[model samples]
Target: MSSAQGGSGEREESRPKDVEAEPAEAAAETSAPVAQETSETPAAAPETPTEEPTPADEPGQAAVTEPPAAMEQAAAPEPAPASEDPAPPPRAQPPNPDGEAKPQRTFTPDFLTELFRNPLDPGYADAAARKAAGNGAVGVPKKILSGVSALTLVALGFLLVVAYQQTVADEPARTQARDTLIEQVQSRRENTTDLSARADQLRSEVARLREQQLGGAALAELQEAEAQTGLAPARGPGTRVTVGDGPSPIDPVTGERSTEGRVRDTDLQRATNALWAGGAEAVAINGQRLTATSTIRQAGEAILVDFRPVTSPYQIVAIGPDALQREFRDGVTGKFFRALNSQFGMSFDVARIGDVTVEAATEPNLRQASPSPQASVRPTSSPSEGGR
Candidate 1:
């Protein structure tokens, strides 16, 4: 019996690791009945109990339970969550005509995502990566080119420094020259004003002498001619018409201001003509007297009267009879201006303020035609000439 037990222990030792993991409790039957020690023929032999060995007693048994990581990997898969927004498909392009195949565009998650995040161009990023990786072997030609480029950049920097220094050095001289020119212009303007005042004084003296020398009829004729020629200032009760620019409404389709709403030279000319027709003795626009030969025309957006620009809110004052306003407002030209006011949102006002003064205009240069020697003779009215 001792030999059989020795063989059994040797067999158990030689078994595989899986068999060693089994608990020592397997030999006992769970349904075995407990013996009752009631003097029944010297109590039956007590049955041995079965108990499993702890993991400390059986080290090889721990290998049967898997690790947490292995358990997670081996777990049954669940359905994937639905994607809220799927990636867009690639953009399509037309087929190449030259048969050189164009690379198909692929969906890139970072194409737009990195634009604002990293605004550097792809070439710049590549250069940065290359620089970070350190430089490789450079050829002789490329090294020479790089040296020359560095030399050129240094030279340009030096040139800019020199230019800036030169400009700074010349600043005082330039300022002095500019000041001299300004002073010269101011002096010339003052001289011209003095000369003009002197000439006006001389002219008044000459006029006084001539008035003294001339008879009543001749003096009266000269004064009337001066008044009519716009060489002398006029003053009287007259109608005043002020015309201003419109609101300058823009065209909705073209997105430009409408020209019809703007005041033009033609409008001033027409108003002046209308006032003349209404028996205006003298007329002026915006304090500038209008002469017979004075021109009213456009220079770009400006309205020039005798080559002098006039701003908006043109005020036209005419010296004429009390019937002057009535004739002008009731005339055909009045209706035309009314149309402009109604259609273009322009401002038109007519008033007769008491005694407005009109300034004298520059004297006009005139060349009067003369009769020939033969044409100057008066023809004698005779019965013989009448019969012929």
Candidate 2:
């Protein structure tokens, strides 16, 4: 009976051992399935150990035996060797204790940590150089790549500087070409106007000779025509008139005023009319004479007389008898000038241009009027030229 009771105690202890072994066997079976699931999931879900109890944590002899037995029933040993060969190298067992080797801890000094903290230090460089020496061909390509990148950047910068200089060198020639074009356009416009005026003057002279003396001697005929039609050359003593305006008015939006300002066309016309009534025979504006066909145009801040730009301080010269100049200086026209100065703050000056040449205003370019009376009788040609 005592042996029976001793056997019963042994059986009870074995039953608890068996219970622990069962869990270990179950864990071994489950681990393969769990690891497979971990591999299938995304890289974010790695095989980290959970906080729950595992058979591996129960480090007893009975628990240790369970995996070998479970694995033996599930798969053959030799078949697993190919997969286990790679896995065991990464997780090599540490040295055993109690007559087994104590683990030799290799003090690696956390080389990665040192590399991050002392990236630019010579000490780190020496270690990296040693590692690179061991790596051989792998490190040589990296050095060559860095050197090539630096050389490429330098070449690009030099090309940019050369291109910029070439562009700057071309600018002056372009500006000179633009100025030449503008000058040629202005010269052509002036020449065209002068030619038209000459043709008209020749036609007027021919008409006069035919009118007075149909068959008189040429010299006698010329004198007769000149006296009859007031065709004598225009010549007289003249007064000179200069006109200018007040300073520019304030700009309402910008609140700024211009310093160099001048008179308007209306103001200039008023002064010209005053001189005409004062018995002036011929009037000239900015060296251009007034004629029946003369046009005064304003462009921006300048006045254009026959396309010639004239600005502030305009000079107007007129030719007539000397009696007209003296009379105009103190006559009703003189009062008009004073009133304009007082009312609008305009400026004016009058002077006598002695022996001034007031050439006859070129005869206007006449579009053939009634084909001139001489059209049927006189010799026909392209067109006659004259100096007016």
Among all candidates shown, the one with the greatest TM-score: 1
State each model's CA lDDT, in order: 0.59, 0.50
Best of the candidates, lDDT: 1
Error of 1 at 279 (Å): 1.9
The number of residue pairs in model 2 that clash at the backbone is 1
- What's the CA RMSD of model 2 in angstroms? 24.6
Cα displacement (Å) at residue 32, model 1 = 95
| Tens digits of per-residue lDDT for model 2, 1-388 | 3332222122112212223233333443444344333232222111111111122211222222222222221211111111222212122333323211111112233456433432333322222222322432344677886899899999999999989888888887898899889899989888887777766666667776665556558756674444322233445567887777766788899898853345777656766677777766677787666765566777777788766677777888777667766776677666766666676666867788677755444443445656576567545442563231
lDDT of 1 by residue, 117-225 (tens): 3232323222222222333123446678689889999999999999999999999899999999999999999999998888788888988999999969999899877
Residue 93 lDDT, candidate 2, scale 0-100: 33
